[model samples]
Target: MADIKLSGIRKSYGSSEVLHGIDIDVKDGEFVVFVGPSGCGKSTLLRLIAGLETISDGELQIAGQKVNDLTPSQRKIAMVFQSYALYPHMTVYQNMAFGLTLGKKGPLGGLLGGGENKKMIEEKVHKAAASLKLEPLLKRYPRELSGGQRQRVAIGRAIVRDPNVFLFDEPLSNLDAALRVNTRLEIARLHQELEATIIYVTHDQVEAMTLADKIVVLNDGYVAQCGTPLELYHQPANKFVAGFIGSPSMNFLEATVTDIGPEDIEVVLSSGKVKVRLPVLPGDLALDARVSIGIRPEHLQEGSGEVFRMSSRVKVVEQLGEASYLYLENGEDDPFCNEPFCVKTNGHSSIRTGDSVDICAALSAVHVFNASGIALTRTTTDSRYIAPRRA
Candidate 1:
């Protein structure tokens, strides 16, 4: 187990820069996940750390050693890619033992002969297989094993290396939905057992949220935000992070600052139907300054009574057994017309398409972003104000 540190890490292809000045710290035995949308350079950054790709600039240190010029094999890191990359011809045991066999030199560089080396390799393989529950399939070929089993074999191969760091690049992308869940759980358990320093890259936020001790959210080759899952979910640093971390994605509505208090600011929606007093630092916000309000689907409740309320026509309703999502139509005149305003409600909700519904959210649940897409500092308070109901 080793700590990994990246300082101002940058990557480029020809003149086009991909990762721009990224800095992250992974403590020993920590599970850190790099998460973002497609083309966000998360995979590229992982490759850089694995030494699979050369760093265009900045420094990368693994276990306190600078390894910018070290080859992938010399980095003491194991990588499990999206594709299993397993040997179809070799049995599970042979595949896992292949790396150890090639590098085995004993104390005198092969003077001890093959017998002792072979036994050592066998022990390592068996231990890894048992941990992953792959012991029963040790003699099976890649073609004979299920997808999940094959993925486990790949992970087991990495385990035998006893690497200082482990890099997983979308390892669950190829698996089916159910397999992904099971494999994800397996990986979590494996991390707990091995206590290895792990850096995982995935486009799925759910994976990052569930597995990572810290999540690095990348956007357009830059680090958008890095924090615990709940930190990014509850207190996003900016509007982009706010929208990207949640499942249904937070809904945004255009508003202008109508009033500003010492500890809070009041904004009225562009539709002129609702005004909300959000517990946000008023900063240099002037009256009539353009800003946006973000509310998560789960935060928006059906009916009224909260501090903030809005009425909109539901365009679609998706029944998800335990819960239902209502997609509300933002009028053509609204700036957010391109995006649907979604509300999560109880599964038993009778609300259907074209139904007009009044939804409300507490002021504490609202996120306020300035015109520049930067989120204002939201203060913690219990003060609430009831807005007048529209006649």
Candidate 2:
């Protein structure tokens, strides 16, 4: 496999610039995923790496070779798009073998004669099919296969090319929920077996968290943060990364600094009922300064806790299989300024809508952010909340 590097990459369309000075490194056999919201230029960045779009500025290297002017074929990268892009008339075997036969001259134009070349191509196709579990459907046409089967065929086609790098652009977006899960697992397994360098672009945070060895979060054509999934989730650089990387999103509550200590700062919520001592550096933060307190839904528990507590009326209760999300009304006077506080509880929670409840969270679970939405450096040394490393 090959390593890919992008330095100060920029992309523009006429007068408008999309990607601005993005720098990233993908080591050999590393699976790096670019994740962000819609219109974040993730897809455009992927296209630039695949040589489908020209870079307005900066350098791109593959396997220690500069390829700014090289064509897609010379870049040695295979792309699997959201659409299957399969040929309806051709069987799976023919579809996978088409890339090997392209631009072939008479007698196969190599040391291996025409017969030997054909055999070689057949072997490659069969091996790819076996790996993807598509051997049974090799003779079937695209129209006869299910959506998952068709997608597997597309991946198998790319495998036969033996590319130095693989590019996947929302490859599972078109599948159903169940199919997407199964296909996602299949792709992860394929990565483990092939150990190919891959760059994937997706708007789904769950996909990004579960698949990537490293995640680069983009926003407004700029790199917000780049780190492992757990690192981004537990220690976000700013409010955007913290909110975007987690499911059920983090809840932001208005608060003011009450006191500052050597290794922590104390803040009181707007309601004046909740006071929390957060383990963060008090960098230039003064007393009575306005700040935000970020707490994840999973961190908030019913009843009282050791650090902070809040009493709110439950507005909605969503009962999921393993857990339930409690949407509590913010006690603030102005409804427009805040969203309902959310708490995740056990699936068998007896709390119902319209019931008054007390929610609590530990000080270690709280994240402090400045008025500008930049996260403060946390001083807590606990690793319990961080996600486990991938096997």
- Candidate 2 is scored at a TM of 0.93
TM-score per candidate, chains pooled: 0.93, 0.93
Question: Would you list the C-alpha lDDT of every candidate in the order shown?
Answer: 0.90, 0.89
How well is each residue in 1-391 modelled by candidate 1, as lDDT tens digits?
A: 7899999999999999999999999999999999999999999999999998899999999989999999987999999989989988999999998778757565676455443377889899999999999999999999999889989999999999999999999999999999999999999999999999999999999999999989999999999999888878888889999999988999998899999999999888887778778899988888999998898999888999887888888989999999999999877654344689899999999999999899999888898999999888887653331112223
lDDT of 1 at 300: 87
- The whole-model C-alpha lDDT of candidate 1 against the native structure comes to 0.90
Highest lDDT, which number?
Answer: 1
lDDT of 1 at 265: 92
| Error at 389, model 2, angstroms | 9.0
For model 2, how does the per-residue alpha-carbon lDDT over 104-182 read when each residue is reduced to its tens digit? 4445453343332778899999999999999999999999999899999999999999999999999999999999999
Candidate 2 residue spans exceeding 4 A from truth: 103-116, 331-337, 386-391
